[model samples]
Target: MLAQILPWYAHAAQRTAAAPAQALTAPARMGWSTHVGFGPGAEILGRDLRGKRLLELGCGPGHNAAHLAKHHQAQVTGVDLVGLQVRRARSHYGHIDGANFAVGHALHHLQATEQTFDAIYSVFGAVGLVAPELLLAAIARRLNPGGVLAFSVPHPARAGRHPSTDDHARESHVTVSDLIRLPLARWEFDAHRWGAHLSRTGLRITSTVDLRHPRLDPWPTTLLITARTR
Candidate 1:
């Protein structure tokens, strides 16, 4: 696995230097495959969020927030690290009541927020952007007592599936492929690892599902995990 991703990680470093990180990440909406990946998990998450507070950290463009608002009728707040992405989210979802967007770092803001959420959902957004411990602590701080948090992330064991069809052994060798690049990303936590972090933070893992299947992945992506705060 390491062999497969070495080139890709090398490539990602160069790309990270070239383009703004936010620009490098495409808007995750607007594709058929995306519907399958996020739609199913969102549906499950939405069910838990009915009449509840839903916080979507690292929301790319507020698409999922819109779903929670329209379908679940939950008070939703979507946050992103990049200002541009947050701007996009606000525009895309301006009309959805109980749905709002902000640009903020997840772990950082939690240290200050007096607000606690009913449920938290992150669809490949903030899960891999920081250290797992920091994120887990942040979740514990921001999530209401007994609140559940769910996320979809690249299954870490499958991290090294890089293709030779790309540049390698050079400074400019970043591959955007999820399998190779995500493992070498600035921050990445597989669902299991994140769950471990949750445990340390006083949250109990209630249930989990491997989102890796023919329907949800070119890489390993898992689904809703309902964890209760202790």
Candidate 2:
């Protein structure tokens, strides 16, 4: 979270989109400076992903897909809009046996895959700026009728701290600094909206949890959804 206060978190989105990750080499992308969360907690869920054909939407550098193939027995593929990120993921990770990463626009690209995956997942930053309806529709088409799906979405409480006004309108202040460092474009869903998409797609919610930050205390800001295709 130091990224937020330091003014980098809010600008990360801009930096990535502008430079298109062209500035960061494969090693640089996987460097010690990287701060995304894809560890033990993610591993636990991944264990359930074994033997499944898993699709990772907006998988930044394929860390989760690497974890899935190496530790969970899943055949994993990562897709992202950024060519450099996809390139870096592949170069740094190699042909991880059962894994691969590709350049993709989650909405249109996924629909063209035509193969139904056993499961689909997105980490905290997977959603990006893709329209919600487009994402769900693609998921509906790509997931086997009874396949599983899961996502880690940010909670609305994180939109910004709210201030009470006893008798007047209050302004909500959002900082570019806050938005950029956090990579928020893909982080725009809540429990209610999650339910809406799943229900329409014939997916059922099976469980939920408040994810603990890897380096800090638990953030209600991080919410996980476990669902199954119906």
Candidate 3:
């Protein structure tokens, strides 16, 4: 399933790479939701991250990783499936003191690396794109004992779709510039279901945050979940 989506992400990388480069500075604040400053920020991870080992799954363009490394002084390693995206990340943030970017599958990278992280996070990244059970299990193996895992996904209600009762992924589309739509598969689950999955994978749920649209939308636009490895 992930293999099928690589080309789409690669195309997206190419398009984004061609655009004018933004200022090479990390964001002043970290955001978990699609909307800027809508939900909880970096405080979800902790008040301080200096000297911490961190991993970011599906770190497109490495912006968040850069923010963590530059602002919080974390040793952040970012991995993405698309090579072009990885290159773009390196080009943009490679000079940051504690930030590094690599190209590979999240599961494979997590399993292959010998090092363990203090925290592993995904911001609308691999947590939803990959199979939950497999990815969560791999994350558990890569995290140090009592480590943190935080990720965000589109709220099921945002698309007017009910959360899946089972573990299978549902078909979805990634809209680009309101013109190009790319096919993809993503898993959607309510907080209870996600808690169950995390528990089964040896992770204890810490908190869940629902970020509703600013305009009083009926449903939340993003759901952020945080867990700790047991």
**Candidate 2 local lDDT, residue 25:** 22
Q: lDDT at 21 for candidate 3? A: 45
**Predicted candidate 1 versus true structure: per-residue lDDT over 90-122, tens digit per residue:** 666776778888777777666667888988777
Better of 1 and 2 by lDDT: 1
Q: Give the poorly placed runs of model 2, Cα more than 4 Å off.
A: 1-48, 159-187, 212-215
Lowest lDDT sum, 10 consecutive residues, model 1, at 163-172
TM-score of candidate 3 on Cα atoms, chains taken together: 0.93
Overall local distance difference test of candidate 3: 0.85
Model 2 reaches what TM-score against the true structure? 0.69
C-alpha TM-score for every candidate? 0.68, 0.69, 0.93
lDDT of each: 0.60, 0.59, 0.85
Q: Model 3, range 1-230, lDDT digits (tens) per residue?
A: 55556545756566685664454788778889877767787888877899999999989888899999999999999998878777778878888999999988898898899999999999988898888899999999888888999999999778577898888989887765456767788898889999998999899999988888768667788989999987
Backbone clash pairs in model 2 (N, Cα, C under 3 Å; residues 3+ apart or in different chains), count: 13
Model 2 residue 79 distance off true place after TM-score fit, in angstroms: 0.2
Candidate maximizing lDDT? 3
Model 1 misses residue 82 by how many Å?
0.6
lDDT of 2 by residue, 1-230 (tens): 23222232233344445543322222211111123433224442434766779888877666777777766667888887666667656765655677788876777677788778988887753442455566777787788867777776554445353222121222222234433322223334456566766788677777766555456643445567777877
